[model samples]
Target: MADPRGLATLPPIRGRVQQAAPLAPFTWFRVGGPAEWLVRPADMDDLLLLLRDLPDQVPLAVIGAASNLIIRDGGVRGVVLRLAGKGFGDIVLEDDGIIAGAAALDAVVAEHAAAAGLAGLEFLSGIPGAVGGAVAMNAGAYGAEVKDVLDWAEVATPRGLLRLTAAEFGFAYRKAVLPTRGVVARARFRARPGQPAAIAVRMAEIRAAREATQPVRARTGGSTFKNPPGEKAWALVDVAGCRGLVRGGAQVSEKHTNFLLNLGSATAADIEGLGEEVRARVLASSGITLEWEIQRIGEVMP
Candidate 1:
């Protein structure tokens, strides 16, 4: 599925590169078109090189483990970077904290921390996506957020690498004001020593609670909309009669109204359109407009 525009102008790298790569298979919703050019760098050095050398005119985006993300129908243009493999997925314990690569799964990191008797990161067990996405956005769940435990994060901007402390991130509700074209390469999270058994019990409770409340087995992105100032998004959705609402092959989860399911046959447009419909309904039912928590990227088909 290589395109004629090709990889000639792109810098050579040790990692894999694919043109017109299908993205739906890896994403949570399992619907979307190909990436125009998908680059998976072999290591930090490879990624930094690509970031520093990539042409400024070329559009760049990092899609880590594609949770809480929707890739639209017409596909993403230019380069899409996905961090994974041995180089990017490693997790190491150091100084009562963990240094997790951008590709490390949030749950995996939580497990690693629990094994080492690290207490503070148990909340990550219930969050979706990778360490990089968690850091990029101030990902939180079950009463804790990235900002609470992060010591520092290493980011690769087009200019090069910069390790910013937690205060430097300027994190707010579910977001951060990072440098332009910044790709979070890795992050160090501080933790305190705790009883491993207690940490295990806490992690288990969070996991069980999440599984019982959310559609963990469904083809759905987690948390469709953010909780408004002092209100809950799901409650607003339920009050608006959006529970089990369907659009094409997309349906609001019966288990949790905030989640929209792919139902095996949804297109990216179907999923996103359903979300917009939910937002519109919520707005009409209540004066408050729901803000999207799941990120919609790529392009929409006409």
Candidate 2:
């Protein structure tokens, strides 16, 4: 997928760009195919340059921690961007808020914020995705969501760099609508002073609760379906007689019915197919449709 003409003319930068790289190692499921081209920009400047100069016809997509994504077995075409190292891994504490880069892990941000005697961000400790993904998904747990603390965000739009406040994000439960012109570079979160040790204890409790209820140890995306209003998805799956149900190597987790586990050898198709079957069963029995939490990307083999 490399452009020979552009490759020669484009001045070399400090970033590393690879062609036809396998994406399995970067995703949580440890499955899926390769990316046509992968770019790890040196920093925000490097990212902007690449975005500006790249051909408009070439496809592009960005991934954060990839905790809730499926890239399919056939792989993704064109350029796939992943920020890493110094460029997108910073966490800074200010007198008023915290500034976290796009690639910074949620747990890392949560821990640092707690250590700084900050409240309101403890809920992030249990989320496993990156900060950008959390914002994009409006990720929440334990009665708290990211929107509650988001002060502003820095995004690299097609027009240029822009700052968006909480109101500009138009956040809803588990969803945030960006400008559609570019990607989020970082976010600033507001917090209030709290006891550091007490906050740490609360975070520990959240972590323990997550480990107890979720298939965190299994090879699976966090939750297969979003909860429908007042009811939980797990309860619905269980009542529909799909608990512990197996299709190929994929099983609806007995530990947590909402989570589907890849039992050692499950293919992407197997996992996805089983999820669909569960959704169908739940809909037939309960008369309510379950929406997928995991975002499926790329195409299936023909």
Highest TM-score model number: 1
Q: Candidate 1 on 1-302: residue-level lDDT in tens?
A: 65444345787888999999999988999999899899999998899888888877788878998999999999998899999999989999975899999999999999999998889999999998999999988999999899999999999887889999999999999998789889999999999899999999998999899989999999999999999999999999999999999999999999999999999899999999999999999999998899999998899887
| Cα error, candidate 2, residue 215 (Å) | 1.4
Residue 280, candidate 2: C-alpha displacement in angstroms: 1.0
- For each candidate, the alpha-carbon lDDT, in order, equals 0.92, 0.85
C-alpha lDDT (0 to 100) for residue 166 of candidate 1: 94
Can you write out model 2's per-residue Cα lDDT over 77-110, one digit (the tens) per residue? 7778888888888999986679999899999999
Which 10 successive residues of model 2 have the least lDDT summed? 4-13
